[model samples]
Target: MVAVTSSVPVTDPTLLDALRSDLRSADYTLDGVRSLLGPVAADALDREEALPARVVTASALASGADGRATLLRLFQLGEDVTRAALDAVLPTLRTAGAERLGLVATQGADDGDAVRAVVDLSPYAAVDAAGEVDWWIASDLGEVARRGALPENFVLGVGGASRTLAQITVREPRGSVLDVGTGCGIQALHASRHAGAVVATDIDARALAYARFNAALAGVRLDLREGSMLEPVLGETFDLVVSNPPFVITPRGEAGVGEFTYRDGGAVGDDVVRSLVTSVGSVLAPGGVAQLLGNWEHRRGEDWAERVGGWLTESGLDGWVVQREVQDPAQYAELWLRDGGITPDRDRARFEGAYAAWLADLDRRGVEGIGFGLVTLRRPALAGAAVSPWRRVEEITGTVAQPLGATIARVLDAVDLVRDLTSEALLGRRWQVAGDVTDERYFTPGEASPRVMLLRAGGGFARTVRTETGLAAFVGACDGELTGVQIVAALGTLLEVDAAALAAELEPQLRGLITDGLLLPAP
Candidate 1:
C-alpha cells in the first residue's frame, strides 16, 4: 500500500520557497482591477505572530471559461501583481514545459515546500471573481513577499458556495465568533473584519496554522484551534458561529493522492454537516446565530427540509433551513470520485474503491443519496427548550452581507408573526400540480413524497406545493386578502364541492401552510 498520512509535515518555511522549488508555480496581477470603491479598513492583521502561513483559497475569482478552465484563465490576468523578485523560477518552469510560477502558499501541496518561499501572484488568484464579492482583502506582511489563494489539497476553489457563505454571514462587532472548518480562515478572516474576538477551528493542523498566520498578518486576533467542530470550542458559547464545514461525502476511510487536508470534513456521510449544525446550537448563546455549509442524505422516506428542520427542533433554538443544491447518487458519487481522481497516478481501482466505499457506508447507514449546500440556524431566546421553527425557500444568491443579518433579525423579531413558510409558495401565484412541481420520492404512512421532486414547469413562484389536493385549491385562493373561511368557500365554489367539507379537508394543510409561512391570511 502506498503511504497516505493524515497530517503530513511540510519541509519549506517561507512564501518564495514553495514556488521556486515546484516544477512551475503561478499567480497573477491585473492592471485594470478596481480598488474598494469606499473607505475600507486597511491592514487587517497587525498584532499576532506568524505560526506558519498558507493561502486558504475560497474560489478562483471567476474570470473566464467554465469550472476549472475559467480558473486557469483567471490566472492569466495577473500581470504585475507577482513579484519579479527572483525571476529565476520562471525560466526553469518554462524549460520544464509548464506554466510559470505565480504565487505559492508558504505551506501546502504534497510536492511543494512547506515554508512560504514563493508568492502566487498569478491572476488566477481570484478564481471566480464574477460572483458577489465585497472586496478581496489580504493582510500585507513584511516577512513574506507573496499574495495568492489556493487549497493545500488543491480542491475546488472559492466557487459559488464559498462566496455564498461569506456573503450570507452577519458582519458586526461582537464578543466572539467561531469559524469551524476554517479553510484558510476566509470566514474567520471575514469575521475578524468586524468581530471583537475570533476563534477558528479545523481538524487539519496546517489549516489552523494558516488561519493563525493570516489572522496575525492581517493584524487581527483569531483563536485558531486544531480539532473537529465544537471540540475545539467546547465549554464555549458565542454570539455567532459560522462554518463552511467539509461536507463533501467522500467514501468512508477513503484517502487518495490529492484529497488535501483542506476540504474533507471526515464524518462518514451527512454526519459531519449534521454535527456542525447540531453543535452550533449548543455553543451559541440564545439569540446567537449559526450559519453553515453542508451535505445531507436525501433518504428514501425522509424530507430533506424536514430532516434539516429536525436538527433545529432538538437544538433548543429557532431555525431556518434552506437546501440550496441537491445531487443524485450517481452524479454526487462521480463528482467526488473525480475530485480524488485528478491527483497524480490515480486509477480506476482507487476511484472505484473510494466510490464503492461511499455507497456502502450510505447503504449501511440507510442514506439514500447525498445533497449539498448552505443552512442557517438561530438559537431560541426562550428557556423552555421548545423550538420555534420557521422555514423558507429563497435563492438569496446575488445578495450582500446586509441581507443575512437583517433577514435573520427580521425573522427572529417577527418569528411569532410568520407561519410555516415556503417562499416558492407565497411569492407567486397559479402553481400547477403534477407538472409544475413534484418530488422524487415520498414517505407513506402512508403516502408522503419521495426521493426527489421534479419541477416539471413553472410560470411564477414555482415549487412542489407540499399540500394535498384540497389544500392546493384553498391556497390558490389566498392572496393575503382572504380569510381561511373565505378561501375554503372560494375553493368549494370552484370545485363544486361543499364548503364545509372543503373547509374540513383544507384546515389541516392550511394550518400547516400558515405555520410554515406558505400561506399568509388577510391582516
Candidate 2:
C-alpha cells in the first residue's frame, strides 16, 4: 500500500465543481461547515496497509445545519461504529480528491490537522500530533456501532450530552460564557447566540486555532484563550460556564484515545472534570450557573452520587446533580477498550493490563459503577453558610432542559421556599389554594394500619386536601370562582366532617404540593 495524494489542477474545472457541490450539499446537511474534503476514501482512512491507493471513496457529513442539531445527530452514531466509518471513508476521499483536498487546505489555510468536520462530520481533526489514537468506527450496526469512523488521532465531535447542554443553557444575553475545554467549541458557539460575548479556552493550541477559525467562519465572535481550564479566566468571573471536558475514565495511550485531544484528558483520569468543578465556583458570578458534563467513579465505600455530589459543594453555590447513566466496571472496560482499537490480534497483554488497571482503580475505590450526567451550580448568596452534598434527581437531563428561562427566573425570584409561596399571579390570572384539605383515608379497611389519603380534583395547584375518611371530600369542592370559606362551609354540610378542620389540613398539604411542583400554581 502506498500513500495517495492528489493536487487540484485548475484545468479540471468540472471535477472541482462537482466536488464543491458535494461538499456544499454536505455542509448544508451537516450545519454550516461549508464542505468536507478527504485526501483519500473514508474506508482506508487509517489503512497504512491501503493508504497508498490512488483513488478510494470518502464521505464528509458536511457542515451546514444548525450546529447543535447537526453535530448531535452525527456523533450520536455511538462510539465504535462511527470510528470505523470515518477510517473507511476519509482515506478514499483523501486519495481520490487529493487535488480538491489540497485546495481545501490551501484555500482555508487549515491544512494542518486537528480534526475538522462540518459539525456533524467530525470535530477535532481526526489526525493528532502523533496520529496514534486508533479509533475506528465499525461497519455493521457494530458496537451499538453508532458514529462513523473518525480520525483515529483527532478528538471527535458533538454528541447527546453536548446537545442537552445546548438545550438547557439559559438563553439570556450575558457578558460572556467560557467553554472550559472547548473540545470542538460547540458550547462556546452555542453560548454566543444569547451571550453578549463568548470565550473558548483549551490547553490544546491546535484546538484553539480550530475554534478560532471555525468561529470566524461562522461569524460568531469569540475570545480564543489558549490556556489550561479556568486559569485563563482567573480573576475574571463569567456570567455562565459550560464544558464537555474529557471524562473518559480510561487513560489515553494504553487505552488509545478515541480521538486524541478530544477524549484523552491525562493519566489522572477525570482530573479535567474535577478541576473544572472545584475551580468553577470562583469564576461564576452571583446567580451564574456552570453546566457541566462529567463521569464520576463509583468508589467502593463511596457512592458515585456522593463523589459528584461532593464536587458541587463549593463555598458559594447551590447545586443540582443528576445521575443519568451508570455502567458497571466490567461493562465499562470492554466499551472503552474497543474505542481504542484493542483487537486481540494487535496487543493482548497491554490491552489486558489496561482493563486490569481500570478494574483495579474501581475496586480500590470501592466503585460499584461509573455515573454520567449533568452538574449545575449557581453562585450562592454570600451570607449563606453550609453547602451540602446529596443525590437528588434521577432524570437530571430532562428536568434541567424542561425549565423555561422565564420560569427559572420566577423560581429564582421567589427568594423563599416554595411552600411559603402563598399567593400566585401569572399571565394575567390570580390563584390561591385555601379550602383544599387532605385526609388519610383508608382502603380495604382493616388491612391498613392507617393511610393518609389525598385528593385534589380541581383548583389551582390542584388544591390537595387529606381526609382520614380516605377522602374527606373537601377537595371535591374547590371552585376558583368561590372563596375557601364558602367551599369549606358547603363541604362541611356534604361530607358531614368538621369543614374547618378539613380546610386547615388542606391548606398545608396543598401548599406542599405546590412547593414540590407536582402542581403549577395557576395564574
Candidate 3:
C-alpha cells in the first residue's frame, strides 16, 4: 500500500448536521446496509473477507442498486467513484460539502472527477443496557478497505472488542464518564446516552480527530482530551469510567514490529494493563464503577486469579475479573502478527523473526501464557466501607447472555446486598428462585433418589452449581410465599433434624446462590 498523509477530519457543526441529514434521508443505517448486502455478503464482511461483498455489491449496483449501495461501496469498500455518482447518493451534502468536511478527496477538476473516501464510515447498531441505538461512526480505513497493514495511528471503528465492552458495561444513568483510550469514540458515544457528561481521552491525535468527527456525526457531545491512559483525567473523578485500552502484551524493543497506537500502549509485557488496574481507582468517584478489558501474563507457578487478584489488591477497589480466553505465547504472537496483515506465506522470514522475538520476550519474563478478560472495579462508597473488599476472579469461556451490562449491574447489587447481611437476617427475608434458573437432576438407573442435583442459570454468566439434597429441597420449597427460615424449619421437622442446625448449614450456600443470581430476595 502506498503511504498517504491522512489529515484529521474537519469539524464543522453545520457540515456535520448536513451529513447526518443526508445519511438519514438516504436510509444509510445498519438495517439499510444489511438489507443491501443481505446475510451472506454481510457475514463475509464480518469475517474480513471482501470478495463476496464486492461481488454482491457489484451485482446489485449493476442492477440499479440505490443510493445506499453507492455510499457503501464508496466509504466501506474504499472504491473511488465519479463525482456525479457520489452526488446522486449525497444530494444534500454533495462532493464539495464532503470535501470540506474532510470525508473525501477529489481527484480531478471536473463534474465527473473521481472522489475517494479519506476515512471509513459505517453504521453501528447496538442493544445496550439502554434499549437499542443506531449511529454512524467514522474511523481510519481498516485492512479490508486498505488491503494491507493498518497505519500506526489508525483509528479503529466499531469491532468485536468495542461490542464486547459495550455489552458488558453497566449503563445505569450517571453524572459523569471517562472513556480512556477512546479510539474513534465508540464507547464514549454509548456513555453519552446514559451519562450527564462524557470525557473522551486518547494519546493519538488522529484518533481524537476521528472521535470528534464520529461524535459530531452522531450528534453526541464529548470532552475530547489528548493524553495517554489517565493523564488527561488526572484530579478528576467520574461516576463511570470505561475503556477498552491497548492491553495487548507486545515485546518491547523488538525491531521491525509495528507499534499500532490502537493496540500498543508503549509498555513492555503487561505493565500497561497493570498500571491502569492499580491507578484508575484514583479517578473513580465514591461508589463509581470502572469496566475495562485487559491482558495479564500468567507466569510460572502462579494461577491466573492470583495474578489478577494482586492487581485488584493494589487498586483497593471491589474487583471482579473474568478470564475469557488464554493463549500460549507462540499462539498469541501469531494471532497479532496475522492481525497486522503479516502472514507466513507473504513474509515468512519476517514473520518467523517477529514470532521468535515475542517468544523470547515471554521466556525472559517467565510468562507462560497471556490471559485476556474483562475487569470490573468499583470504589467503595465510603472510606472503610470495604475494609475487606469484595474480590472475585473466575473464568467463563462459554456463551453468556447478550447485553450483560444488566446482569453485571444485578451482580453488583446482589454483592452489596449480601455483603453486609448476617446469616440470621438473610434467613429472615423471603427468597424466590430467579426466572432464568432451573433445577436439574441425575438419577442412577432404577433408583428413586437422584444421585446428583444441579442448579443452572440460563442467562448472565450461564453458571451451573451442584447442590446437596437438603439445599435442593430447600430451593424447591421457595415460592416467594414463605421466608427462608420457615422453609428450613419445616424441612428440618420433616427430616427429624434440628432447625437451627439446618439453617446454619444452609446459610453460606444460600448466600452463594444470592450472589450468583440463582436466587433473588423477594420483595
Candidate 4:
C-alpha cells in the first residue's frame, strides 16, 4: 500500500475549539455557503464545476466580503488568501494557529503575506432518524480544487457514494458500530450519531489521520485503526457495520493503467466485493446488519443474480441486493477514466489508451457490463432460527426517496415476519395496503373492465407491479377488514375461480408485496 506523506491536520483541542468558534461566528455552514453563493453557483459547485463559484467568490472578495467568503475562497476554491485577511476572519485561531493545525501553509519567505489551505474543510448538514446535524468535515482537496489527477493515496471528502451509503444506512441506536474503509470517516461520523461506540478502520494511514482530525473537529470520539477491510475488527462483533468499500474493478498490470488506493482494492474482477460479502458475516453480532455499496460484474452468459446470490449463499446470512444502475463496458470505462481526471478533452491520447486498456481488461474477463448497487446482510438473531438463509437480488433502476433507512428496516422486519409463515398462517393475518401504495387501471376503448392494472409505490424503491384481474381484485380488497384468506376467497368468488388455486397463486405475490413494503401487517 502506498503511504501518503501529505500534510494532515493536527488534533489540537484548544485550536479546534478556536476554529469551531470562528466558524460559528462566521456562519460557515451548508446553508450559509449556499445562501452566499446563490443557487446557480452552488449547484454548479456541486457538479464540480468551479468557475461559477470562483467568479462569485472573487466578486465577493473584491467587495470586501465577510469571513465566510474568505474561508470559501481559501478552502473550497483553493485560492491563496492574504495572511492578514485570514487573520481577520479567524481571529480566535489566527494565522499562526491555523499553521499549527496544519490547515494552511505559508507562501515564500513572508509568512504574514500569503497562505493557502492545505486541506479541504467544508460545512456538512443532514437530517436522518436522529435529527439534524451541522458539522465541519476536513479532508484532502479534490481533483477540481487540485486542478489535476488525484494521488494514489489521496484521502477523499464526502462524495456521492458516501452520501448514498449514509442516507441508506439503518440508523437505529446501537451499542457498537464499525465502519470499514472509512475514507474521511464520513460513514463513521454518521454512525457516531446513534451508536454508543464507533470503531473505524482504513488501510491508508493518511485516511485514518484525516478521520481522526474530522472526529475531533466534530467533537465525536472514534476508535480509529489502520488495516484493510475486516482485519482491524477480527473476532469482535458489531451491532452494525457500514462500508463504502473500494469495490471498483480496475485492471492489473495493464499499460497506462494506474491503481488508486481510494478506489482500487488490488483484486481481480469483483473479488473484493465478493470477499466482503462472504466474510462480513463473521463480524456481525446476532441480528446485526451490514450495509455496503459495491460494483459487481455482469459476465457474459452468467446471470448477475446467480453470481451475487452465490456470495450470499456462502455467507450464511440473510441478504438483500438492490441493483440501482448498470453500465456497459465502454460507459463504465469512460466514467472511471474521467473520474481519475483523465478526460478526452484534456488529454486525448492518454484517455484513449486508458480506455482501450479498460475495455481489453474487461473483455479478457468476459465482463459485458457493470452493476452498481446496495447490499444489506443480517445475521439471524436466534440460532437455528432459519433452515436456510434468505436472499433477494433485484434491480430497481429508478429514482427513490432519500432517508431510506427506515424503509429498509421495515422491509427486513417484514421479511422476518413472513419468512416462517405458512400459507394458512399468512392468510390468518389481516393486511393493509401501505399508505404510499396506489393502483392504476388502463382500459381499452369502450371496454367494460380495465385491460391492465398496475400497483405503484410512492416511496421505497418506487416499485410498480403489473397486476392481473385476480391479483388486482385481491389487492383492492386488502383494507385490513379481512384476513388474507377472506380476501382471496372473496376475489375468487367475485372472479368465478377456485379459491384454493387463487390462494396458491397469490401467496408468493403477497409475500413479495409485503417484503417490498407495498403491503403491511395491519395493527
Best-fitting candidate, measured by TM-score?
A: 3
Name the regions of candidate 2 deviating beyond 4 angstroms.
1-27, 30-153, 251-260, 267-271, 343-350, 380-518
Give one clash count per candidate, in the order shown.
Answer: 85, 88, 0, 0
Q: Over the stretch 433-505, how does candidate 1's per-residue lDDT look in tens digits?
A: 2222333334555556443332221322233345455664554555555555565667778779998776556
Error of 4 at 309 (Å): 1.5
- From the highest lDDT down, the ranking of the candidates is 4, 3, 2, 1
lDDT of each: 0.49, 0.50, 0.88, 0.89
Please tell me which model should have the higher lDDT, number 1 or number 3.
Answer: 3
Error of 3 at 410 (Å): 0.7
Which is superior by TM-score, 2 or 4?
A: 4
Local accuracy of candidate 4 as per-residue lDDT tens digits, 24-99 = 9999999999998999999999999999999988888889857888999888888888888888889999988998
Off by over 4 Å in 1: 1-157, 216-219, 254-259, 301-306, 341-349, 364-366, 385-405, 416-523
Looking at model 1, report the run of 10 residues with the lowest lDDT sum.
36-45
What tens-digit string does per-residue lDDT give for candidate 3 at 25-48?
888899988898899999888888
Q: How close is candidate 1 to the true structure, as a TM-score?
A: 0.56
Q: Candidate 4 — which residues are off by over 4 angstroms?
A: 1-5, 108-112, 344-347
What is the model-wide C-alpha lDDT for candidate 2?
Answer: 0.50
Instruction: Give the number of colliding residue pairs in candidate 2.
Output: 88
Output the better candidate (2/3) by lDDT: 3
If the candidates were sorted by their TM-score against the true structure, best first, what order would they fall in? 3, 4, 2, 1
